[model samples]
Target chain A: DMKVTQMPRYLIKRMGENVLLECGQDMSHETMYWYRQDPGLGLQLIYISYDVDSNSEGDIPKGYRVSRKKREHFSLILDSAKTNQTSVYFCASSSHGESSYEQYFGPGTRLTVL
Target chain B: QQQVRQSPQSLTVWEGETAILNCSYENSAFDYFPWYQQFPGEGPALLISILSVSDKKEDGRFTIFFNKREKKLSLHIADSQPGDSATYFCAASEGMGYKLTFGTGTSLLVDP
Candidate 1:
């Protein structure tokens, strides 16, 4: 089955601590994205990776970093966790081309920083 | 600046009523528009989408109306049900790639 999986559905971390959110997809899609969703504010794009080493910053790339070392894996790392970074993080992937606009999202990871 | 804007922050409608969520974009390069539905504590899912070439697209009770000149589009959900209550987001893509600009989102509540 085609699915996107996110490890640690929920996480709690202390300020200044480093955190990692892992995402994997079984579809072998060419494009992967990370977005953070908050109340009132919609999902904000953080980063998008087209290939193993190609990565681009989206609108809200600050305070967050991503790595796509493999075709089916994309990871988001928080260099220093902060209270303001607490939000629901979503991982998605899509194929290459115009018709692949739709993104298949994972269950999501809710991170809390104290 | 926010590339896309959504209005009515939220809407409450009775069952069987039609719920209309509006979205507008500022980028003229946007050629594709898609609506995503997100449930509480869950990831958003693709609901429906429309292309610049077509003025309208429909799927079951969900329909998307696009206006290329206005750079605006709307999602109409007919016969709103309690299960349909969720957050709706409108997204636009300029050229290609998986990069998309999303709206602030409009939460819909359907009371039965």
Candidate 2:
């Protein structure tokens, strides 16, 4: 089955702590994205990864970083967790070229920074 | 600045009724528009999409009506059912594989 998986569906961290959210896909898609969704603000893009080791910052990348060491895996890291960072995180993957416009999303990770 | 915007933060409709969700964008460069449906505790999923070249696209009971000149679009759900109740978001992107700018979603309730 084609699917995107996110680990630690829920996480709670203290302020200033380092946090890691992992995502994996089985479709071998070349493009992956990380987004944070909050009430009223909707889904805000955090990062976009085009294949292994090629990542670009999205509009809301200030407090987040991403790693894509493999085509099927993408990780979102928060260097120093902040209370403002508490939100639901989503990971998505898509193929290259024409089909890149369609993204398949994972279940999502709900993170709480206290 | 919000590039994409949605109207009627929330809407309630009876089952089998037609529900309309409105969306508008500010950037002229945006060429691809897509609507997503998200249920509570789940990530958003693509519902329907329309390109600037096409004025309308239909799939089953969902249709997207686009007006490129006005930089606006709307999603019409025909015969809406309780199962279709979810938050709907409007999003736009300028180029292929580019990050999408999303609008604050419209919470839809289809009461049976």
Candidate 3:
């Protein structure tokens, strides 16, 4: 079955600490995305990776960064965790061609910054 | 500013009743609309989608009604069941655009 997996399903970090959330997909999809879902904000995009080493910032990219060193892996990095950064993060993947815009999401990572 | 918006922050319906969730977008460039269903502590899953070219699309008991002129769309759930009681989100994107703009979800509750 096609699937996307995220590591560290739940995380807690102190303010100003560095954080990393990992994601992997088996479908070899070319496009990967990172998003943070808040209470009334729905899913706010953080970053979009087209392929290995090709990443673009999304609407809410101010406090986050992403790395896509391989086709099957994508990582979201928080240089300095802040209390306001606490939210559920989701990783999604999709092909560039046939499944142009349909994204398959991972279980999600709930991060709490104290 | 939120490009996509959903109405009726929360809705309660009885089983076997039809539940209507409304959505509207501000960007005219958005042509593809999709609805996602999310349960607590889980990721959202794709439920149904519609393109600007088509006015209606149906799958199983879920239907999407689109209005290109009004930049609005809605998801109609026929015979809503307790299993279908979950948060529903409306999302939109431009043609071939990899990014999607999502709206604040509409929470649904189906009483048995």
Candidate 2 chain A least-lDDT 10 residues: A94-103
* Whole-model alpha-carbon lDDT for candidate 3: 0.94
lDDT of 1 by residue, B1-112 (tens): 8889998899999999999999999999988888999998788899998889899999999999898888889999999999999999999887654678889999999999
Per-residue C-alpha lDDT of model 3 across residues B1-112, encoded as one tens digit per residue: 9899998899999999999999999999998898999999889988888888899999999999998889889999999999999999999989847889999999999999
Highest DockQ: which candidate?
3
What does the TM-score come to for chain B in model 2?
A: 0.97
Give the best candidate by lDDT: 3
Candidate 3 lDDT by residue in tens digits, A1-114? 999999999999999999999999999899999999999999999999999999999998998989999999999999999999999999999886764467999999999999
**RMSD versus native structure for model 3:** 0.9
How far off is each candidate at the interface, as Cα RMSD in Å? 1.2, 1.2, 1.0
The runs of at least 3 residues in candidate 1 whose Cα sits more than 4 Å from the true structure, single-residue gaps closed, are none
Mark the 10 consecutive residues where model 3 chain B has the least summed lDDT. Answer: B92-101
| Native contacts kept, each candidate | 0.89, 0.78, 0.75
For candidate 2, write residues A1-114 as lDDT tens digits.
Answer: 989999989999999999999999999889999999998999999999988999998998998899889899999999999999999999999885655477889999999999
In order, the Cα lDDT scores of the candidates are 0.91, 0.92, 0.94
